[model samples]
Every structure is written in C-alpha cells, then in structure tokens.
Target: MTTASEPRTSTGVPLPPAATDQPPAPPGPAAPPQGPPAGTAAGTAPGTAPLRALLGYARPHRAVLLGTLLVVLVASASGLVQPLVAQHVLATLGSGGSVVGPIVLLGVLVVLGAGLTGLQSWWQQRTSERVVRQVRRDLVFRLIRLRVPELDSRPPGDLIARVTSDSTLLQSAATEGLVLVANGALSVVGAVVLMGVVNLELLAVTLGVMVVVGVVIMLVLPRIREAVARGQQSVGAVGAALDRTLGAARTVKANGAELRETGTAGDAIESSYQAGLLAARYVAMVKILSGVSIQAAFLSVLGVGGALVASGHLTAPALIAFLLYVFYLASPIGSLIAGAGMLQQGLGAVGRIEQVKQMAVEEDVDDASPVAVRTHSTAPAVEFDDVQFSYAGRAQALRGVTYTVGGGTQTALVGLSGAGKTTMFALLQRFYEPTAGQIRIGGVDIATLPRSEVRRRIAYVEQESPVMAGTIEDNLRYSSIGATDEDIAEALRVTRLDALIERLPDGLRTQVGTRGVQLSGGERQRLAIARALLRKPEVLLLDEATAQLDARNEQALRDAVDQAGRRCTVILIAHRLSTVTAADQIVVLEHGRVRALGTHQELVDNDELYRELAASQMLVGEDGDPVEDLAPVS
Candidate 1:
C-alpha cells in the first residue's frame, strides 16, 4: 500500500484531453538508499570482521588445504637448494675434482620440484571449487528464507549480485589467496636466512631496501579494497536498472522510452567502469613496487659483495650464491604482493556476502509452544480489534479500522482505491504486522499462531492476479502440491476455467507464458481464482476477482462464490458496487476508516459515501430499483 490518497492506475474510457491527448505520467518505483544498498538488513557495517568471515569459509577444507600446502612446501624447499648446489659445483670445478655427484643431485631436485608443484596446483584448485560451491549454496538458502519485510525493502537484482559476483570473488581469495601469502612468506624467510649465512653485509643491504618498499605498499593496499567495494555497488546498480526496465518492458515500449532506459543503465555501467579504474591504479602501483624492491636490493648486494670479495672477506663462489638468492627473492616478493591485493579484494567481497548472511530470515514457529492452534474445523470468524497499521516511512494505511466478519458468510469490502482495502487482506495474511490492535480468528488472537499456520487456513487472490512461468498444472499445484487432478478440475469448474482448459490442445498441461502473458486478462484472473480454490481454505479473500470477466463469466463466478460462502468465510473487495449488493454484509471504507456497515440497501439509504459510489456506477439513482435483479457489470 503506497498512500491513502493515491488512486490505483485504472484503464477506462479515454478521458477528455487536458489540452492534448497526453495523460499524466504515473509514478515510478521508489528509489532505495544508496549507502551500503538497501538489500542488507541490520548488521555491523561493511568493514567489520570481513577477514574472519573469509577464514571461516575455508575452515572446513583446512585438511585438504594443509596437504596441498605440504607438497608446495617441499617444492619450494628443493628450489631453495638449487643456488647452493650450483655453488658446490663451482667449488668442485675449482678444486679440479669430479662434479658428476653434484650435477645429478641438481637434476633430481629440478624434476621432483616440478612434479610436486603440478600436483599441488590441481589439488588446491579442486578444494577452492568446493569452497565456492558451499558459499553459493549457503547464500541461496539464506536469501530464500529472508522475511517478507526484508525482501520488500530491497532490489532483487542487487541481492542476486551477492550470490553470483561476490561468491566468485571468494573462490580464489579464500583459498589460493591464503596459500600465496603463506608460501611467499616462507620462501622469503628461507632465502633471507641463506643470504645471511652466505654473507651478512649483503643481507643487511637487501633487508634495508625490502623494509622501506614493504611499508609503502601496505599503505596503498587498503585503498584497493575501498575502490573494489564501490565498484561492486555500481555493478549492482546496473543490474537493478536492467531489472526495473525489463519488468515493465511493454510499458516502456508503449511510452517509447527505450532511449531513456538505455541511458539509465548506461550511466550505471559507466560508474562501475570508473570505480574499476581506481582500483586498477592502486593495483598497478603495488605490482611495480614489488618488482622495483627486488631490483634495488640486487644492485645494492652486487656492489657490496664485489668489495667484500675483492678484500678477501667473501669467496667468489659465495658471492655468486648470494647474488642468486637475491634474484630468487623476486618470485616470493611478487607472490606476497599479489596475495595481499587478492586478500583485500576478497575482504571487499566478503563485506557484501556477510551483509546477505546477516539479513534476518524467517524461522519456523513451534506448533505447540505457548499457544496451540486447533486442527479441527471451526468457524474462523475474523475480527479486527481497532487495527492500525502503517508502512515504513509513510503515513498510516489503516487507521483504527475495526470490523467483524461472520463465519461462513459473504462479506464485501467496498472502497475507492487505497482506502485501506488491500491493506486489510495483507494484515490478515501476516505479510506485514499491524502497528497497534489485534486480529482474532475463531475467538483466538492470530498473533499467537505461527504465520504459516495462520496462512494455511486462508487463501487470497490479488487484483492483478500474477501468474508464474510454467505449465497450467505447475501453477495450479504451486500452493497445494499434493492436490489431485480431480481437485484441480473442480476448482477450474468453480471459476469457469474448465471450458477454457478443455479448448486448449494440452489441457491441464498447457504452458502459460511468462507471467501468463499467453492468457487474456480475464483468463488470468479466472486462473488465479481457480488456483486459490484448490487450497480448500477456511477463509477466501478475493480482490476484484470479477473485474476482468464478461457478464456471463462474472455471474457464474458470483454463483460459485455464493455456494462456497455457505461452507466457508468469503470476503471480497470490489470497486463496482453492483456486484456486492447480494453480499450478506457490506463494509464501506473511506480514507482509512470504516464509513458505514450494513446491508447494501441499508447503506444506500443511509450512507452518503456508499450512496455516491452506487450512483456513480448507476447501480442506484433518484428512483433506481433495487440491485438484486440486475445482472452484474464486469
């Protein structure tokens, strides 16, 4: 429910042009807050505990990860010995002794290291895939179970981006990203220790250069994380733009708004690109610094070691091994830099994924906790005890609305659009809770019962009559999956859809196009009614069920409702006053308040609002006859 004063968009006779044929433009979807996006429910801000959450995703795969890391460790250790072995070969040559033993050992180390590295690569990737799969599955499960209000508050496209794009980021960041950082640190430490053993003066020169460069790079990495977060949000906005436009594709086309929508989506795309460039700028700087750090250290070591060897403090072979170690240090520095960047990006992704995880989801209520709902059939007389409700950030939709609907009777709610008509049904279904007041069903307060339990006893068909993408049988069986074929036929008969189904070549198996675009407006309305009837609910609430039907089908539907009313509570909302004249009770609402309550004739005689509505439809006039004998207009 949007606003009490806003009328529903209606399709009727063309209005007299206000200077031209153009009609006043309808409103658009309300924009959600841009900060952190509206999709995330209440939780800690984006930066909190992202690293811990990333570690948690890989915790279950630690054993496999440990095994893979051991293989890489062996490979790295063998590579570390290559330079030392070369020094031995050089010494043996200088002594004029056999070098066969040293040469064979070097060849063996090379083969072993290569083999282990290959095996580790494959094993680590397999584990990474498993981690990604679990994260995606968990996200999907939690997203589907989120409470109604959370879903109502967010854009679906943005939420979907978390499951898809964010999880993909986690794929490497949680697994290989950690491996890179750990292995790089170990390799760097090993190379530094050997460099110290070979020559302390050279090691001092290398350490000084490394420490300064490391500090500079650390400061810039966090900026990458911030840029990535902004980029993810822009991408989500792009998705939202496309989703909004595609949902109303026909409306956009009818208004010739292709260019306008194209610009909207293009703008979002441009924002994403700009954000990507910022992150890229930071990332490129880190890579350049990593390379520069190694080159600077090598130059200092070369200059220092040359003087040491010339002064007879360092041997020629030792200087060569020390130089080899400095060059070997390059690989570890590069990996360390890459790993840190990946971790920062992963943390950014985790921020989005964690927001999804924190969003509140509906929990199943215990059937026998503090209150027990009766399983046996009872007249579910609905009573609204001064019900007052309001949407978030909006004025009251229903204000102190109170009424009692007798069980097993036909009651109609008559009001102009947004007079709290649809809101009444939403409250009954527990889609949104009432702000103040109580709703009782069968002398028991409904709030004490579980939402699923409350909904099980009632069925509702909305005015638009939305349809799903599937065959007729699939949609009919959506609410009651266990319903039998015979039950479906009976429901179709009641809503006067049996004949239409029979006319189709596929009968019950006929495919309904997306949102049931394959069916006419009247046919879709009837199909929704049929689907609701199959539930055999204790209470049936229809919102303009007959609005799209022809005279004959509308009368047939009313007859079916009249029959069902004898066995169950039937309440309906109707803008056309003629259809509700035969109702056992009529509640007239105006501006979120009940204006009058009585039989249709009584209201016509006494209530000005009800009388005006009736007169507008020509249902009653100065000397108009009673409405019961007249056929209802669809």
Candidate 2:
C-alpha cells in the first residue's frame, strides 16, 4: 500500500522512489489555484508574456493577417473621406454654390466604406478560424505525447475545455483585437489632425478632456482582464464537473445519486454564473467610461469652437466640420477599449495553453522502427532476475522475483490478490521499471530497446477486457492493422467466438455499445483473447482472461491457449489452481515473493498455501481427494 507522504504519478497512482540511475519524473499539470482572482490587476497578473506567446501562433498566417489589416485601413480611410465630403457640401451651401458635386462624392465614399468593412470582416473571420485550428492541433499533439504520469494528474474535461472554449477566445483576440487596435489608432490620429485644421483652440480643448478620461479608463481596464481570467477558470470547472458525472453515468444511476450529481454540477454552474457577473460588471464600467469621455469631448469642442466662430477667428463651415470630427472620435475610442478587453481575455487563455505546452512529453519513436525479432535458440523467452519494486514508500510489490519461461511454452503465475502478478506484466510492458532488477526477452535486456519495439513483440489482454465503442471488427482489428479477413476468422474460430459472431445481426460489422455493453462478460473476454491472437505476437500475456467465462467457454479457451502456446511464449495469471493443473510449470507467489516453483501436483504436495487455496475452491479435499464435480473451477 502507498503511504500518505509518498509522491504520486500524474494519475494519482503512487510511485516507488526513483533509483539512482533513473531520470527524474516529468512535470505535472499546472494547478488551478495559481490563476488570478477577479479583482487582480491585469498588467501585473498574466501581463504581455502570454500575449507574446499567442502571437507566435499567428506568425505562420502573417500574410493573411496583413491583408485583413490593409482592408480595415482602406475602410477607415473611406469613412474619413465622408466627413470631409460633408464639410465640402456645407461650405458650398454657405458660399451659395452648387452642392451636387459634394453630395455625389459623399455617396461614393459611403458605398466604398461599407463594401470594405464587409470584406475586412470576412477575411478576419477566416484568419481567426485558421489560428484556432492551429492552436487546437498543437494542444492535441502535446496531450497525446504527454507522459503517462502527467496525464493521470489532470482532469480530462479541463483539458477538453482548453482546446474548445479557451481556443475560441484566442480566435477573437488574434484577428479582431489586432484590427481594432490598428484601425482605431489610425482613426483617432486622423480625426485629431482634421480637428486641428478646423481650429487649434477647439482641438486643444478636446484633447485636454480626452487625456484625463483616458487615464481613468486605462486604470480600470486591468480589472476586466482579471475578471475574465477568473471567469474562464470557472468555465473549466464546469466542464470538469460535467465530465465526472457523465463518464460514470451508470454508477450515478445505479446508486440513485441523481440529486447528488445534479447538486455537484449545480455548484459548478453557480460559480461560472458568479464569475460571468463579475466580468460583465467590469465590461459595463468600461462602456460607461468610454461613453462619458466621448460626450465630454463633444461638449468641450462645441463650447470652445462656438466662441472662436463668434470672434470671427473660425468660419461656420469649419466649426461644423470640427464638431463632426468630435462625434467621429467615438468609433475609434470604443474600438480601442473593446480591443484591450479582448486582448486581456486572450492573454488569460494563452496562459493556460502555454502551461500545457510546457509539460514534459515522452520520447516519440519513429513508427517505422524495426520490430524486435526472436532469434535466440536456447534462451528463455521471458526472464525476471531479482526484480524488486515498491509503490512510493510502501512495501515492495515484487521482491527478488526471479523466474524464467522457456520459449514456445506456457507458464502459469499463481498468486492471491496484491501478490504482484499484474505488476510483473506491467514491468514486462515497461509501464513501470523495477527499482532494481533486470527483465529480458529472448535473452536481450528489454530496457535497452525502445518502448514501441518492446510492445510490438508482445500482446497483452488486460483482466477487464476493455473494448472501444465501435463495430465488432473495429475492436478485433484494433491491434493488428494488417490483419486480413481470413486471419480474423481463424482467430474467432480458435477462441470459440464464431458462434457469437454468427448470431449477431451484422456479423463483424455489428456495433458494440460503449464499453462493450452489448456483449456478455464471457463473450467480451473471448473477444479480447481473439483480438490478441490476431496480432500474431511473439509473446502473449493474458491476465486472467478466463476469469469471467463459463465452464464450456473456459475449457474452449484453455484449448485455444494450448494451441497458441505451441507457436509463441505464453504467460498467464490465474487464481484458480485447477486452471494451471496441466501447465508446463506453476510459480506460486505470496506477499511479493516466489514461494514455490514446480508442477501443479508438486506444488499441491509441497506448498501449504497452494493446498489451502486449492481446498477453498474445492479443487482438492482436506483428505487429499480430488473434487469430482468442479470442472476446472470455472
């Protein structure tokens, strides 16, 4: 058992202390507690670091982004011309001249501006989608390659939310944020210059008022970033809660915990609601500030410019044009404020994405790497030499376990629960390395080979017989991609699954419900075995494959195992002594140590623990008489 103080794997499984020769553990998922609260200042929180990283995602599509920006600039410039055209008409009327020329020009400018705005929007949206696709692709690539330990420590729903909801926020930030900042700045500067041309005194008044209000708005802008960051965190929490309940839907239903699960989900939803309210409060404040500043600038420009016009220092047409510019300031100022908010939210999301990217990933090997071939003529197919392993400060799970299974022979591992039968297979599969020991396959140390190469040479059927949600053929061919129809049919026949397949309405194409709910426990076990057989691996590891089977199926599976044993090395774990009675050898384990190694009869006669276990299942009587009714204790 693992101790409380022990370090755990990413999946919460306790790990043994690292050997001196072993590398350090990989970095785990970023903790949620490190995120900023709703009231924290955005400048001092996530800051520009995340924004810079987000820009890297847009680098490859810079040409499209630049084109989009050019369109936005053209649209803004066209809009600026409208105000000038209007001024020309007003001046022409004041001078008692024809207004037809100015009116026609104004109409042309409006049409051109509207068309450019539509084009800009389409291009921006397309670019945003491309950025989103790239971000999600990188996230998924990192997720699949992340070390197993790191994967164990994180919630699946939270990761999914990062890819879906968080990436969407980045979409808006990447395109809209860039365009707003660029176009809004240009519009503001152009408006100021036009106002100065009308009257410098009025221009000064407008700038003075705007400067004061802009500072106040800038101070409040950071608060929106903090609120949005917290809101996104709450959204991730909601996703995690939903995943927890839905993933185990049957368990919740079976236990009549509907109300309890609903309550759990409700709490998460409430948190998200509260966070959203906080974000909205900040956003509303930003809008109010922007509106107030624009109104103040308009009043200032009108009062100052009217006085200049009365003094004969400014013309009526010029005053009217200056007022128009004051009104036009609203568009760009509003865009600037909104863009800042979007960028802040994007920064928050990028922070989370960056955290995932920083996680340590396992080494990826080439899929075309050569598979290990069995070449040894006299060496044992599998050998464990003084293997020792512990689960993070706990007693050893496997202690000095030394054993060998000859090539092309069957070996039975007979042990009680927690006696390290499964751990042995884990070691062989290289899921966890022994603290001190050597494991070999075909006389070659497995540690010297790539993980993929080792796994390619062996096929494992777990005790639970897990199946994916797909057709019968999908699950069967999952391991062996190149398996032909004839090979699959032969495997089914060998595992006695031909009858089950024939009964199905669609035969090999029949869909298996989630977790193989459509199949019986016995049928699922046989299917798992058949799937392994189809791989044609050099070594086959079966972890209690017949544990769920009926007597007839168990006998048929045993015959199938016997047939497989003739072609490849077979290692099996069985609790029932009768199952291993005719095995080539039986290795009895107790408390992480090998207690005896001999034939079934030899163990029954020499090992007390074996006899007691055999008696409990009625495989043998206390008086040393064999039970007559038990058919291999199936």
Candidate 3:
C-alpha cells in the first residue's frame, strides 16, 4: 500500500494524446541500419534453412496446400490450351482451314479454368486462416511464458504489434501471395516447354534472357528484404515511443510537452516511411529491368524466326505458334520478379517474429522434487544470509545483507530509496537471483523450491500494488482463482475495501479502469491487501504498503495488517519511523549493507545513523526514548 508520500510520475496519465490521436511526424532522411536482407546471408553462401523453416508452417495444412497446387496446375494447363486454340483458329482462318475443333477446345478450357479458380480460392483462404491462427496462438503462448525480467525491457505496444500486424503479413503471404507465386511459376515452366515444341532455337534464346533476368532478380532481391526489415524495425520503434508517450500522456499535457512528444513520434514514422520508400524503389527498378529484358527477348525471337522463315526452314503457322509461346513467357517473367520481391518481404517478417522466439524462456522446474506449499497457522519465518544483487548494471542494489524474522514476529526494513529494501523482497520472490548468498522461507532455500511454490507461500503487496487492466473482481481473483464471491467479500472486508466496493455502481464487478485509475491510491492499496488476504499466504511482504495513504487510510491499513498478522508473518519495508516502531525487529540498511538490526527504540539509542534519522524526524521523547506518537512495537 502506498502513502500520500509515495512518488508518482510528475505527469499522471496512462497514455499521451499523440498516441490516440495523431501518430508522430515522419522522420528526417536517415539511412536505415545496415544488415543482410531477410532470407539472405551476408558474406555467406545461400542456404536452404530459411525455406525449410517456412515450409514447416505449411506442413500441418499439407493436404490443402497440395490441393492448391493441383488446382493451380490444372488452371495453368487450361490457360495454356487457350493460347494454342487461339493460334490454331488464327492459322485456320488465315489459310482457309477448319476452326470448329479449336473453338470447341477453347470452350472446354474456359469451363475447366473456372472450376480450378474456384477451388484455388477456397483452399487459399482456408489454409491461410489456419496458418495465421497457429502463428498467433504460438506467439501468444510464447509471450505469456516469457520470464518477467526479459519482458520488463520491452514495450507493450511493440509486442502487441507482433501479435497483430506481423501475423497479418504472414497470413497474406501464405494465402493469396503463395497462390500467385505457385501459379506464376507453373505458367512459366509450361510456356517454356511449349516454346521448345514449337521451335527449339527460339526457345534457347528465351532461356538465355530468362537466365540473365534471374541473375538480376537475385541481385535486387536482397535489397528489398533489407529495406523491408528496416521498415518493420522502424515501425516497432515508433510503437515503443508512442507507448511511452501515451503511458505518460497526462504528464506531457500537464507539462505542456505535447509538441515535443509528437515530434519524437513523427520522427519514428518518418523513419519507417523512408525505409518503405527504399524497398519500393528497388522493386520498381527490378520491374523496369525485367520488362525491358522480356521485350528484348521477344523481339530477338521474332528476328531469329523471321530469318529462318525467309530461308524456307520454318512454316508460317509454326512461326506464329512460336510467337504465341514467346508472348506467354511475359507472365512468368513478371511473376518471377514479383515472387522475389514478396519472398523478401516475408523473410523480413519472419526475422522479426524469430527475435521474440529466440529469447530465453523461464526455466522449467523438475518434477522429481515437487514442492507442495501449505501455509501453517503460525506466522511464517524468513532468513537471509549474505545476499548480494545487482540490477543488470555494475552497481549493487544489495550486498551481504543478512537478516531473520521468526514466526509471529513483525519485521520492518527501513532505508532511503535504493537502500536495498526492495531488492531484498525481489530476492525473496526470485525476480532476480542474488549474485552471492542465500534466502530461505521456513528453512527451505527459496531457490531450491520451484518458483510457483515459493511465490504461493509469500503474499506481496508492493508499493505501487499494480491493479491490472480489468474489473475489480478480476484483479482480486488473481491471488486465488478458486475464490468464491463470498470469499472475495470476506477478504475485502478484512482489508476495509468492502465499503469502497459497496459505493461503486457494480460493486465487486466494477471496472477498476486501466491500472486502477478509477480507484484512489489508498483504494488500490486496499484492493492489493484484499487480494493477498484471499491467498492467505504464510508470509506477508509489504513494500511501502502504507507510504501513500493519508492518516485515516494509514490507520485503516495498519489495522488490516494487525488483523491479518494474527494468522501469518508480516515483513514490511517502510521509510516512516512511526510505521517501523510497531515492528518486533527493524533492519536498517545503508549502502546495500545491513548497518543495524533491532527494535526502533533500541536502534535509536545505539546506532548512529538510526539515531540521526530518528532525531531528524523528531521521533524522540524528552527522556531520549522514542516518543509515544512513534508507536513502539506492539
């Protein structure tokens, strides 16, 4: 529970205005980060690993994918027959030959084409939806299981983007995009084969042009992938910035910093825009080159075939057929370029998705030493021995900090902010392991027990006492899922939140609003306590639980603690001497080390820092004893 004295953001609001209204302005012209484009390696030869990974997603829907392929092939074959029919009809009309059979064949081809098109559409949508669903489920499950520390470093908006935007891209790529690529590839192959049948020499010229185009496409494709990946990263960066700004929206408006925050967001958007343009530029260039190359190849075939016809080595009908085959070649050549471009885009998305998957997940516990936690009726005891911890940085938050509290005893940790009090509780919860020493609960080393077991036995009500974005009942139920409404009422009664709930329109089911904005600080703190009480843990850890309350709320919180402590151990972290005076033991930490350990009165009389602190607060009486207002340990 927080006291009125607790620190809050200078600007108080959940999200900034720019996030909800306008996105940030575009970034200035800055080059994207240099890296190998997605699906391509820098300084390394090409490999099949990327294709194998992509194919894995398709494996589950193999039957539908196969069906799609068959439909595409049938559709392509039917389409090929049209060009043949057209040439036959044209040659017949030109030379006064029969055209009835060609027209009938063309009609049959049209009907077959329609049927295959319908089948392809169904399979494309169904298979895409299924794969997208699988990806979303996997990503969500992976995110939920990610350890707290890793999650702490990421922004929620960017993570949400992965679940939403990234998955959508994959869906498009798998469905309509995949169908086009496959069909286009088949059409190219069929056209090449038909060209060879009509005239082998002209077919050889077409192949040479295709080879050159392929080489150019290979060279251009990596650029597209690199640009696309940069674009995605820029989008994520924009999201992170917007999330931060919105999370502090009130502060920005209150402080008149909206313009500044908007500028920041705008810069991020510009970066993404620029990256998109870069990718688009390369795509345009590749399209132009392929178009010119295909036209050149067609003209070359016409020239070569004309010379052969002039030499009396080729028939007019045959030459016309060869030209028709060459015209068919244009579709595949365009498809090849488009496919390369799309392949790059998909690879870029995969790279982003893989970044999340690669993070180390929380360690799984072994089943052999199963830990079963049952809170005893008596107060829970806790012990720490030479614990040392650093918060990612080099400076230590706790060092050689040792303390103990027995069952039925009340202990308080008092120090300035960053004096290791919060770090001690973090160690007990195993949010971060100590670089040295050990912490134990009821004689069992905390690290030895499974995380779930350790946390189940300790009820923690932090200073902020985060009230999640849900209904009051939903947030309270987190402590004990099986808790009935009656049990919830009882816990709320114990923490003095029943009155607050009764006043709410929906009582227990009332929406607390995001981060409990609907509730006052004290109310939020009381709700946290109610949650803890419902769990009925053996040990209760309160970090500045009463630091944010007014006098009346503080008294209410103190009384709730007294009532609950009758059944469990209470370890409180406080900066107020009045709060600590009631503790059976007070542990004073200075610069990450325990400097004094005793009751408030004893420490005030002996320890220099403790004495100075007590006097500064004027907590001493005329007789040099702790003042009555200080509320000595009960």
Q: After superposition, how far is residue 441 of candidate 3 from its true place, in Å?
A: 1.6
Q: What tens digits encode model 1's per-residue C-alpha lDDT throughout 317-375?
A: 99999888988888877877888888888888788787776665656532242222235
Candidate 2 Cα errors over 4 Å, as ranges: 1-45, 365-380, 386-401, 433-436, 585-596, 605-612, 621-634
Candidate 3 matches the true fold with a TM-score of 0.87
Best by lDDT: 1
Q: What is the TM-score of each candidate against the true structure?
A: 0.90, 0.86, 0.87
What's the lDDT for candidate 2?
Answer: 0.77
lDDT of 3 by residue, 1-634 (tens): 2223121221121111111111112222232222234334333233354444456667788788878988878887887777778878988899898889899989999999899889888888888899889988988877776654445445655666667766776676655566677878878888888878778998898788778877887898888877877777777667777777776677779999888878877887998899999999999999888888778788988899899899998877788877777776676667666766776676666666655665435454323322224656576689998887655433666778788888867888877665777767867877656777878888888877766778778889988788998999898888777788898888887777888877888987899887888888888988888888888778889988876677777787788888777878899988777776778899988888999999877887788888877766778754457565664321
Q: lDDT rank, highest first?
A: 1, 2, 3
What Cα-based lDDT does every candidate model obtain?
A: 0.79, 0.77, 0.73
State in Å the error of residue 111, model 1. 2.4
In model 3, the runs with Cα more than 4 Å from the true position are 1-52, 91-97, 174-182, 363-377, 621-624, 628-634
Better of 1 and 3 by lDDT: 1
Candidate whose TM-score is highest: 1
lDDT of 1: 0.79
> Model 2: what TM-score?
0.86
